[model samples]
Target chain A: MKRFFILSSLLLLFLAGCSVQHKVVPAGNDVPSQKYKMEVVFPKGEISGIMAFKRAGGNMYGTAVNEFGVKVFDFVLTGGKRCKLKNVTGFLNKWYIRRTISKDLPELLNMDFAEDALEYVNYRQNIKYKLILIKE
Target chain B: MKQATIIISFLLLSILPVKAQTDNEIIANIEKASKEMTSLQCSFTQKKQVSIIDEVITSSGVLYYLRDTKLCWEYKKPYSYKFIMNGDKVMLKSGNTVNVFDTKSNKMFSQISKLIISGVDGSGISDKTRFDVSFATKGKDVVVTLVPKTKDIKKMFSEVLLHFDVQGYFIKEIEMIEPSGDKTDIILTDRIINKSIDEKVFHIE
Candidate 1:
C-alpha cells in the first residue's frame, strides 16, 4: 500500500509538470496595409493571384498565396528591410519531428541547435522553406 | 449508290449541329461577354496553379488591362517575368531574355484568351452552343459545369467549371479539365470593377 501511494504521487507530479500552458501574444505590424495582389506567369505556365504585401515595414514580407493554397514569403525585402528571423518551429504536426527549412543547415545539424533552426517543413514531400534576412 | 448515300447521311447528321454551335452560339457568347468586360482601369489579383515536382509553384504579379487585347502582366517577386500582350503579338520578358509570340498562330494563346473573355463576361460556358451546361449549387455559390458536346472542343478540354455567386453574376473561379486529364484552376479575387482604367496602361512599351 505504501509503494502504491508513492507511485501514484509520483505519476501525479510527472503529469503536473507536463501540463500545457499556452500564452499567445498577437503579432502584427505597426504600419497599415498598403498592399495589392498580382499574378506571376512562368515560362512553362502561369502562377496567378499573388498578394504583394508591399510597403510593409521599411522591410516587407512579400506573400504569394499559390493556387494549391500554400502561402510562402521571403524574410528579406526592399533596400534595407530584412528579417532577424530566428528559427522557431518547423511544420509541427502533432509530436512528429519533420524536416527543417533554415538556411543554417550546418547549425541545425549540430546537436545543441538543430531543432531550434527548423521553420516550415513537409514530411511527405521533404519540402522545406527557409527565410533569410536580405539587407536593403 | 445506296451504301454511299447512307454513309454520307450518317456523317452529315453528326457534323451539322456541331458546326452550327461554333458559328452561332459560341461566337455570340464571346461577343456578348467581351462587351460587358470591364473597360475600367483597375489592378486585380490573380492566382495561378502549375504542378511541378508533385507540388504546385505559385508566384504573384500585377495585371494591367488596357484597351483592346492589350494587357501587361508584371511579376514583382520570387522571379521577375512579364507577359505583355499587345493586339496580335504576345511578348514575354524574363531575366535577360525576351520572346515574342504571334497569338494568331498559337492555338494555346487563343484558347486562353477565349477562356478569360468568357470568364470576365459571365456568359455561361455551359451554353448549349459550346458546352452542355449544367449546375450544382454548393452553399451559396453555383458551380456551372460545361462539357464540350462538340468533338473538336472535346479534344481540347473535357470539362470546364465556373463558379458564380447566388446574388450577383460575378464569376469567382474557373476550373478547366483538359483532355489529357490534367486540370487548371484560376481564381480571381479582390476585383475592382468599373474604375477609370487608362488606355495606355495596356501598352508594353
Candidate 2:
C-alpha cells in the first residue's frame, strides 16, 4: 500500500509540472493599441503575421495580416469571454482555426496575461507556436 | 477540288507561322527590354475581391526589384509588412520581428515568389513550359493571358493576365484569378527602371 501511494504521488507531481497555470483577472474597459509579430508553427508549415490589438468601449478588437498585407483574420472579444470573428480568410474560417485564434488572442492581449510579459509560448501535441510582442 | 484543298492547307499553315512569329516577336521585345533593366521601383495599388464573401480589400504598397533575383515588397498602408527575397533566401518582417526561410524548404512560397518576380520583369510570359500564353487586345491595352500548366499552380490560380501599354512596352497592371473566382488586381504606377537602388533596401534587419 505504501509503494502504490508513493507511485501515485509521483504521477501527480509529474502531471502538475507539465500543466500551465493562468491567473484570471477582471476585464478592463480599454486597452491601448499594441502591435505584435505573431508566428504560428503548425504540423504542415509555419506562417507569420502582424497582429494589431486595440480596445475600445469595453470590447477588444484585433486584426492579423500576412506579409503580403492580406487579411488573415479579424475578430472582436466582448467582455473577455465571448469571441466574435468578424472576417476570416477562406482556409481559416473553419471551427478549429477560429477556436484556436479566439483562445490565443485573449491570452496574448488580455490583462490577465500581464502587460509586461513579452513572450507567450504554446504547445499542442506536436505543434508549437510562439507570440513575441514587439515594442515600438 | 484538289487544287482548292491544297490552297486551303497552305493558307492555314502560313497563318500558323504568322501567329507564332507574332508571339515570338512580342516575347523577344520584352526580353530585350528586361535585359537592359538593372533595377526597378514602382508603387502598386492592389485590390483583392473575394467572391464568396462579396468583399473587396484595397491595399497600396511599394515594390523594389533588382536584376539576378532580388525583390522587396513593402506594404505600408492599412498594415505594415515587408517581404524581401534575396537569391534563395526570403525574409519576412512584421512589426519588429523578422522570420527567415529558405526558398528550397517551402516549395509553394518559392513558386509564388518566382511568379511575382517574373511577372514584374516580364519574364513569365516567355516561360512557355510552365504556362500557356496567349495575347489579346482590349482597347488600347495589350493583354497577355497566362494559364499555368502545372497542377501546383493551377490549384491556387486559374489564370493570370498582364496588361501593357503598346507605346511604353512596360507592364501597367497584373490580375490573378483564383480557382474560387477570387481576383487580385495590381496596378503599377510611378515606375523607375534601371535606377540605382541601395543594397541596404534588401536587408530585413
Best by lDDT: 2
Q: Report lDDT (Cα) of residue A31, candidate 2.
A: 34
Model 2, runs deviating above 4 Å: A1-45, A48-65, A69-136, B1-18
Residues A10-127 of candidate 1: C-alpha lDDT, one tens digit per residue: 9998776554111111134433322223332323444333333333334433333432223322222333422322111122212222122223222322223223222344344454
lDDT of 1 by residue, B1-77 (tens): 99999999999999988766644553454445445665523333443331211123344556655445666666655
True-vs-predicted CA distance for residue A21, candidate 2, Å:
43
Interface RMSD, every prediction, one decimal place: 14.3, 10.9
Model 1, residue B181: distance off in Å is 3.8
Top candidate on DockQ is 2
Judge candidate 2 at residue B110 and give its lDDT: 87
Instruction: Give the alpha carbon lDDT tens digit for every residue of A69-105 in model 2.
Output: 3456666677877776745665566988788767765
Residue A99 lDDT in candidate 2 = 82
Error of 1 at A42 (Å): 18
